[model samples]
Target: MENRSHALMTGFFTITLLIAAVLFGLWFNRDRVERVPYMLATTQPVPGLNPQAAVRYRGLDVGRVSDIDFDPKVTGQILVSLNIDPDTPITRSTFATLGYQGVTGIAFIQLDDEATGSPRLATNSTNPSRIPLRPGLFDQLEKRGKRILAQSEEAATRLNELLSPANQKVILGAFADVSATANAYRALPQQLEPVIARLPALADQAQGTLQSVSALAADATRLTRKLQAPNGPIERISGTVERVGLSLEAVGNGVELEALPHVISLTEDTRASMRALKNTMNNLNERPQSILFGAPGTPPGPGEAGFSAPTK
Candidate 1:
């Protein structure tokens, strides 16, 4: 009976061990899938990333990063394999980016769903697009601060060189010269005020002289207009003066007093000649008709009036 109990106990323990192993196996395979015939048609490597990490989408485990290896043919190109979940659908525009998860700084792939209008990305595809990761603002600011510090150090060195003894002397000398110039300029106003004050009196005197000159000019203009008046006394005086001038000019040219009798005689002779010419012309005009026909018998000479040249 004891031997029979021992056999039964041993059998029970064996069954329990098998059951435990099976449960453990089921638990382990919960996250693991059968190695399906997945293709690695394309792959992209992100720098500064670990290959053993899992690729996640919205905090869900989507794929595992398979390996990191340099391309044998393409120098400087790193190829990474990602074992994607067979159920996870990605589009042609789907891309991979690397980022740190939480505070560990361990990099992971962030798979994005881009299947809205894009075709499904084929599996086992090589040459998947690599999106460059951008540093955060704080990281950028840190880098910028380092650069600024370096520049500031350089600028300080340059400034220190410029502020050496010789440069200090030059700057101080310039300041001294500027101060002396300012002092001289400040004193000049005191010396110049009297000179500037006299200018106003000089200006007033000049203005008064100008006023007197204007008044004189106005009087001159009035006198000139008076002299030009058409029938004013000035015009008559001008005419008398002109006549006197002509008389003086004539006398200077030796017009003699004795020539007056000859001139008078010529005038009288010309008058008589003019009268005789007029009489002669009058007679010549009338004599033709009178000769052709006797004078129209109007009591011709008192003796012949009644006969009248036979009244022809």
Candidate 2:
């Protein structure tokens, strides 16, 4: 009876200890799995990311992707559900991207935060809480690789066409011509020796010429700047012209202009002298010496006929 009691007691104690241990373990891990759900919708390719893949925020492991499926509301859109730590500071500014581990190519969710002060989002009653997903570096590289492959395909086709038999024949003919040209220039070394010998002097002259050109350019730049300065030659010349215009305006306003057509009249005595001179000239042919003297008897004083006494 005593042995039976002891054995029963031993079995009950063992069961209770196991149950207590299990409860303690559950209590210890209670905070470890306090996951908050978040949804991500994207049209971009998310390569190699599977459920249970790690979700990293700023490269630190936070939680894991829980599920991936197409959104029922939006056709052709992928919805990735994540279960992150409740304590994660996933504000409105937080973003998620796909990432790859270096050599393994294992994809994960990489989270980054933008510069915003928005509050942390809570699970919506009507809809799953959503986060935005942008294209990752691997996505960009894959797209660029596709483009490069397409370009390479086109280049390969072009190259095949370019190297066709007929094109190759033409290229060979061109090569032959080039060979003939090269043969023609077989004596070029001897001919070029003199020219090559003078190259140093030519280089020196070129250097000097370039130096002169540089100096000239510097001078031209200086001249241009001097001409363009606010109080430079252009401004001074304009000022001088303005001053001259003002002076001319002042002079024009100060001076008085005279009237036109000032005429002088001949006097009566002068008219009488002219008449006497005309009569002398008329009788000049009759007696040439009368010019030095006067006409006989004062030319009969103006209008009377010449006094000749009594003509015979």
Candidate 3:
């Protein structure tokens, strides 16, 4: 009987000690800060999120998720309840999103305020201020997965078309043409060898022609200067023209003054001689024997000193 009693006492003491230890642990880990309740409603899926998930205010541990359930009032809507510290500065512009802890897939509530000057959100058990739950990175990627897959398929189809047999043949043909062009370029220097060899002679000929042209131009310049000189060809020709003009004037004066009167008097003497010669010719024609006798008697008229009226 004493042994049984001692065993019971030992068990009771052990149980009491365990209970005290648990109580002390609970007291040490208890949260002393006053918290405000908030609700998050979303229609988007919250993967890896559950009750007791940590709630962070801009990366700071501010609270924990208390509950997650479908909204009883709205169909297809989820409601998440959070108990955030009263000093967390939750406001009307504060919002929440689901975030993951690295690659673990563990989700938490990330709280952030869009406007710092927004009015404080007031809440209680009866009605908590609702925060909008926006789609997380994973959720957005999942939603766009189908569209991304469609675009990838389109890109693959285009790549296949580009690598088709016909396109491959065309590409090979273009490479062959490029090789031919390279061969042509390699042979071009040999083809131009003859022309290159003649370049020195051509250069010498061009230099000679240029020198000749330069000499001709210099001669033309000298001739132009001489023509423009005061005592040059132009001046000599002008002086010659003035002297010729004076000589012509002198000849004209002499012709009009001395030569003109002499010519007129000579013309008058010639006229008288012509008249006497004409009379002598008429007398000889009337008496043809007078030419041989060298004489002709004058016949008198009625008014003469030896006036004779001859009978018929």
Candidate 4:
């Protein structure tokens, strides 16, 4: 009886000690932080995602997924529940996506805010605030895979058409033409050698022509300057012309003031002489012997002069 009681007491002490140790461990592992509840809803598939998956806010661990279920109210919609730290700053603009660990296919919730200044999301145990679950990288790729495949097929078809036998022949012909052009380019310098050799002579001739033109221009400029000089040949010629004009004026003045009077007197004297000569000519015509004999004596006149009546 004593041995049995001792064994029972020892077993009880050991069990109590194990129980205290377990309680201490539970106390140590208890979460003291208050966590806020959030809900995420989506119609997209969440591959490799399960309950208790880590929830991250911009790559930081902020929470854990609590439950994943289908919405009974909305058909074909999934609902994911999360318990996040209260300080995680979940807001109305916050969204969720599934991220994967490297090559492990383990999916976690990735939370991101579209706008940092969004109003805080309100939640309670009965009605948690909802975050939208958007498509992940793999989901987007999977969704676009058919279109990408179609485009790739189109590109491959175009490539095959472009590389057909006819196009290949055309490409070879173009390459041959390019080679011919390159050969022509290589021979261009030799073809231009004669013209290049003659360039120096041509340049010398052009220089000589330019020098001759310059000399001509200089001579013309000098002649123009001489012509424009104040006391040059132009001035001398102008002075001579002025003197000639003055002499002509002086001759005109002499004719008007001195020679004009003499000319008038000479004209009157000549006129009187002409009148007497005309009278003498008339008398000689009447008497032919008047030139040799003196004037006939005056005959008795009726009055006082020699006037006589002829008897018939």
Candidate 5:
């Protein structure tokens, strides 16, 4: 009975200690501990990307993924729930990116709180958006392989069509026509050999002609300068013009020989008329012809005094 009591006491103490330790641990961790809810939202099982996975806010343990579920209508999209601290107001600008912690490929939820002025997310919202950033290489490779397979199928169909007898004949005919055309053009260079050979000589002749033209242009320029110099044809032409002007002035001022004779005759006729008038006036002055005559038949004869005495 003593041994039994001792054994019972030891077991009781041990059980009590274990319970107290558990209670103390719970009390100590209660403030930091969080409950994460889980839901099957995604059509595909994102294993490591679970609600119980750690939700880091800017590398701090701010929250955890709460649940994941799929909509009844939409395919391939997983609605994820994140349970963040109530005090942590996540805004609309807040982003959630699915990420892997390490090489272990253990996926976790990373909430980007670095975005400024983010609004808080509602808890009752059924649909929560996640940034599509963590598709694995296998997923990308699978999509790429599907696209390549589709392209290969199309190529195979085209190849089959092109390999048909009619297409094959057409391709052969095209090849034959190309070969004939090439054969025809093969002699074109040979036929143009003479023309090609004459090109260099023609170019040389053109250069020579250009040089000769340059020499002739220089000579013409020199001749133009000579003609423009002092005592050239221009100066000679000016001198000739001056001389012609002087000659014209002299001719205009010179006396006319035809009018000289007429002027002389006019002067002689005027002098003669003046002399005749003077002589007539002198004779009239010398002879006083107021004689006493009878009224009907009195005649003034050579002896006018005799008639005067008879009249007296």
Candidate 6:
């Protein structure tokens, strides 16, 4: 009876301790627990994704994927449901992306929002609160890798084409031409020897011509300085021109050549009349009273020969 009582006491104590541990655990994790629902729709392959996968927003645990199923009406589309904490700000702009468990290939849901002040997600008849799933960084890198691989392949193909046998033959021919050209260049110094030998004579001729030119330039400089002197040919010429101008001004002040033509005409008329009177006298001396009977001949009129013109 004593043994039975001891055993019963031990069992009772064990049961009580287990119940207390359960209660304590519930209290400690109470704030950490959450279950807010959201729906996600995706058409892309969700590799390594499954129900109960962790959902994180900016690296903090916010929820878990609760279910995944294909929509009956939409081919190639899957409907995913999540249970997130109510505090999770899953706005209208919020989206989900696949994240990995570092080398494990295990995928989780990563939520992010870029739209500002957008309304919270809501359910519709055809679609639930659709937190659109976009390709993650890994998926983008994978696509870029595929593109790079294709480009590399194309470049290698072009390179192979460029290095084909025919092209190689052409390259060899070009190399041969280059070698011939190099040999020609190597012999150029010998070919230039004769021309180089004449360089000293050519240089002497050039020096002599330069000396002559220098002498001529000195002469020209001296002549230029003489012409530019204060009392040089230019000054003499200017003085001579001034004297000539003064003489012309004096002549203009004294001479009245503009009336010379009228003076000459009057003098000719007077001289002709005088000669006529002299001739009449000579005729009358021979004929005595012929003036009364009319002289032997009439005297000459004006502008006749023997007229005395005027002088300037």
TM-score computed on alpha carbons, candidate 1: 0.41
lDDT tens readout by residue for model 2, 203-230: 9999999999999999999999999999
Task: Evaluate residue 226 in candidate 2 and report its C-alpha lDDT on the 0 to 100 scale.
Answer: 94
| Least accurate 10 contiguous residues by lDDT in model 6 | 121-130
Predict model 3's lDDT versus the native. 0.93
Report how far residue 312 has shifted in candidate 1, in Å.
Answer: 95
lDDT of 5 by residue, 1-312 (tens): 999999999999999999999999989876575533222244444656765677776687867666667755787866776666656555556655556777887887665655676665454445433433344445567789999999999999999999999999999999999999999999999999999999999999999999999999999999999888999988889999999999988776665656777889999999999999998777566654523331245567766755544453
- What's the residue-level lDDT of 279 in candidate 3? 95
Question: In model 6, which residue pairs have backbone atoms overlapping below 3 Å?
Answer: none
| Model 5 TM-score, 2 decimals | 0.43
- If the candidates were sorted by their lDDT against the true structure, best first, what order would they fall in? 3, 4, 6, 2, 1, 5
Kindly indicate the candidate among 2 and 3 with the higher lDDT: 3
Candidate 6 lDDT over residue span 86-143, tens digit each:
7777798888899999999999999998977888766543444678899998999999
Give each model's whole-structure lDDT. 0.72, 0.87, 0.93, 0.92, 0.71, 0.88
How much does each candidate deviate from the true structure in C-alpha RMSD? 17.6, 18.2, 18.2, 17.0, 17.2, 14.5
Positional deviation of 172 in candidate 6, in angstroms? 1.7
Residue-wise C-alpha lDDT for candidate 4, range 105-171, written one tens digit per residue? 9999999999878899889989998999888888888879978999999999999999999999999
Q: How accurate is candidate 6 locally (lDDT)?
A: 0.88
User: TM-score for each prediction?
Assistant: 0.41, 0.49, 0.59, 0.59, 0.43, 0.61
Q: How far is candidate 3 from the true structure (C-alpha RMSD, Å)?
A: 18.2
| Poorly placed runs, candidate 6 (over 4 Å) | 1-32, 115-128, 192-219, 241-312
Model 6, 113: alpha-carbon shift in Å? 3.2
